[model samples]
Target: MTQRRTPSGQGPARRPGRTSRPTQRVRVRDTSSTRVEPRVARQARPVAAKRTAAQKGATKRTVAPRPRAITGRATVVIAVLVALVLAYTYPLRVYLAQESQIAKMKQAQDIQRRLIAEKADEVALWSDEEYVVAQARERFYYVRPGETPLIVLNDPAGAARDAGHAPAAPAADRWYDTLWSSVQAADSEPRN
Candidate 1:
């Protein structure tokens, strides 16, 4: 029987069912020629095996990195910021309200100041004797003790009648004479 030799030419051929150790490929340079070659020719793996190895390597390279979880320090920082805002909100609102109230009070004070000035001027005017006397005479129709009071009736008789007061009759007609004349006229009239 003839024995078959392996491709490396240093071992007996492997049987189809027998397991053997894997071969390592080593590169060698040919000094005579400028080309490089493998010292021992490697056996080709099956297509399915080659594809699975390639897919595993590709998945390793292309897989995305996992997202990192938030650290305790970062959480604490955010919490502190939220707490600070909550703490200051009420005080800020109160400060603004007080400022507005102060402005309103100042406005009311200015109005009061103006009123006081006007009253002061009125009081000054009343302090003068001549101004007080003039106001009293004009409003109350008062006169000095020795002064002759001449009352002028400038309005027409029609104005007096419209005001519900008829013009006075001549002073020559006494009240009794007018009354007797009226009685005689009434007696002469026919009864209705």
Candidate 2:
């Protein structure tokens, strides 16, 4: 163990610090006394590395954030979509109702056409005077020009056919077997 003592007696350590080794001091030339020592101190720990209020103030400036924008396109699109749906739905409902009504009107038109055809046939039949007279005689037992009226009971078919086709007994037929049927029918007969 040798002692390193500078001519000024100052060395690498200014004060004694604890070490795990026995004090085996070595003798070596100390370079700290040279004029280059200040640069050496600056190399070990820079002045900029230290924390200070003036140094913190030199940091880059930041701007406060502007308010975030609220996009309204999506809201407008949804509103338009709802309006379009209503527009389409209203017409669709009206079209369905109109379609059903058109079907009912067509059915009524077909019934009217059938009735017109039947009425045209009856009008043609009524144009014949013989048809008018025959119809009046059959329904009303009508006589014309003081003609004597006779009921002929001959059967081009049979007597059973005549009796079968004769005017149906009135509603009284069911009341008293045959008695009320005769009376009611006689009472309702056209006066000769």
Candidate 3:
């Protein structure tokens, strides 16, 4: 609302104005300097003088603007992906390993069940009178009461061949083992 008087005591009421350039507005801003830069100071700036010819010949100047700054979306996406993978990696590995272990345990349980069933069948046979008599005759070469014992010739070489490699036993343990065998034979007998 106020017309700033120049240092030479003139205001905007005069005809001398900054209408020389069309686009470039040279409004006299309220700077700290009392006067505009002198001609001597302008000539001292050689860099500005060298651009006078280029400014006159060019209608448009190609100015490369600065690249846009990075958005935070890419950083957020990478962080989320990293966190998701880190959160699931341990649990995924543990689940897979446990699944594998469970499969092995199932297989082992099936084998143990089959072996236990076979042992149960053997125990059932041990309670039969015929099985008890057969085992005593074959494994122990036992004879019935008042019967003469006759050795069979089948696989006679197998017993003598392995005899040298057989472990030695104390005579006291042999007597105890014979007593245990007689008890087992009595126990293996069928109930009336």
TM-score per candidate, chains pooled:
0.43, 0.34, 0.44
> How many residue pairs clash in model 3?
0
- Model 2 off-target regions past 4 Å? 1-83, 144-148, 151-192
Residue 28 CA displacement from its true place in model 3, Å: 68
lDDT of 3 by residue, 1-192 (tens): 444555445444533533433365668688786677755542355754676465654333335556567658877888999999999999999999999999999999999999999999999999999999999999999988999998866764577567765554445667788899999999999999
**Candidate 2 residue lDDT tens string, 83-145:** 999889989999999999999999999999999999999999999999999999998989998
Q: Which 10 consecutive residues of model 2 have the lowest summed lDDT?
A: 36-45
Instruction: Return the lDDT, model 3, position 32.
Output: 82
CA lDDT, every prediction?
A: 0.79, 0.72, 0.76
Best by TM-score: 3
Candidate 3 Cα misplacement greater than 4 A, ranges: 1-60, 63-71, 152-192
Count backbone overlaps in model 2: 1
Report the C-alpha lDDT of model 1 over 1-192, residue by residue, as the tens digit.
Answer: 444554444434554555776666966666786765677886776964876577642322233456569888989999999999999999999999999999999999999999999999999999999999999888877899998767766777878888999798867888899999999999999998
Q: Judging by lDDT against the true structure, name the best candidate.
A: 1
lDDT of candidate 1?
A: 0.79
Q: Candidate 1: TM-score?
A: 0.43
User: Clashes per prediction?
Assistant: 0, 1, 0
Question: Between prediction 2 and prediction 3, which has the larger TM-score?
Answer: 3
